[model samples]
Target: MDLSSELSEFLRTRRARLKPQDVGLPEFGRHRRVPGLRREELAQLAGVSVAYYTRLEQGNGKNVSMEVLDSIARALRLSDTERAHLTHLAKPTVKKRQRAAAARPQKVRPGLAHLLEAMETVPAFVLGRRGDILAWNRMSRALFGDFDSWEPHERNMARMIFLDPNSRDLYPEWECKAVEVVSVLRLYAGMNPDDQELLSLVGELSVRSEEFRSLWAAHTVTDKGHGSKRVRHPLVGEMTLAYESLKVSGDDPDLMLVTYHAEPGSASADALRLLAQWGVDEPAKPADVPE
Candidate 1:
């Protein structure tokens, strides 16, 4: 993605989302060509000169200061995720060598993998920065279906949300889930605009799914932390699971360890226990005999 163009579009869209009343400005009986706060109005609110703010909005503010950016972010009422995205776009640190190195496959640490395995009853998985399912436990497989069954390239949550038929049926509120998935990816894209894999994934999804295309164009961003999700597993019927997304520390700061749990003594908890039993009872696939 062209950093300048992305920055410009992001600013424009964010600016267009706010109205005069949103920022406590009076509406005069004058004709306005553009929607939301005018450039001069925004500049005034942000305590910046119109000319400087115009240059920043036009993607010419390569040397934009953080204080000014912060002021603009507050003026536009950007969320934490959106503010971070703005900072990334305004001051990108994409070196060709770093971009090339990031293309390598990310692996879950042995300790994390062991920890996941130890939580036999909890549905847990480690996700890479790009939402790829790097590693998952047996409960995770039982809860979300077997990621091992899919090709490596097809193991992305965003891709599954838009492209997989099973995912649509799995989530009760599929549209909302889809939007959240896209929002998380939007955050990743902003931070690493030069990542070829990320760009390719976005491009492929945009071409394949019209829904994805429209949402991507919206430029909405969000941080994926703790949340509750309802899913209808074929084996367990319907269950609402509360999930937590914890960022892995140390070497893999971008990796997230996600785990799901149901309220104690609830039907969802019973369903999860039953699902675990089913997993234990199910026979393993027979190995193929070599000819």
Candidate 2:
């Protein structure tokens, strides 16, 4: 991954989205060469010299202070997540010696799989670096398509959303889901800027899915939090499920424990019960949560 190029593009996209009047500056003429504020205009807003801001935007952020980044972030009207992304991009997180560390696949901690098993009624997953489905419970198999059946390389949420046809049926609002997945993936990419595997995934997705390519160009950054998702199950039909993503305490800080539920007495809740019973009727499958 080219950190400098990523940094430049992220800043450019953010800058292009704004206009002179959008940031309280008066628009003097009807037309301009660029879509958003010019370098001079952004530099003025950031209280910096044109030369310095240009250099920073060109991806030469060495020795750039947090105060300068904060000022530029404010000028761009960036959100908290975007602000963090900017910081990560401007300041490279991984050193040259640490690039080799990216090769190691993240491992889930001991007994985390059991937690997923304990929540039999809810579909749960233990996801590691770059949305890898490191572990999942039997209920998850019932709710989500069988992860156990997929190859390790195929067990990724982002890949499934775009490349897997089953995902189209699962997500009613597939476009929205794709954007969110890409945004989360972008945030991770910004942090682990040199993760070869992640870059490879991005390259493969970009080559295969036009939607993924477009979303990747947008450079959206978002954090995963509690949210509601509506999925259509082949057996039970459409259901709105509430999901919570909790960052678990483990060796891998990025490991997430994601679980889904539905409101009590609602049809969606009943659908979950039926799925659970169906899971029982079928032959018991091994809960292959990685050790």
Task: Pick the lDDT winner.
Answer: 2
Model 1 lowest lDDT segment of ten: 282-291
Top candidate when judged by TM-score against the true structure: 2
lDDT of each: 0.86, 0.88
Q: How many clashing residue pairs are found in candidate 2?
A: 0
Tens-digit lDDT track for model 2 on 1-291?
777888899999999999998999998889899989998999999999999999988989999999999999999999999999999899876776556556777776557766766777888888878888888878889888988788989999999999998999999999999999999999989988778899899999999999999999999999988899999999998999999999998566778999999999999999989988885855434335364
1-291 per-residue lDDT for model 1 (tens digits): 787888888899999989898999998867778988899999999999999999998888678999999999999999888999999899987778667657877777677777887787888988887898888888888888778788888888998899998898899999999999998998888778878889999999999999999998888889889989999999889999999999999865678999999999999999999988876854332111122
Per-residue error (Å), model 1, residue 207: 0.5
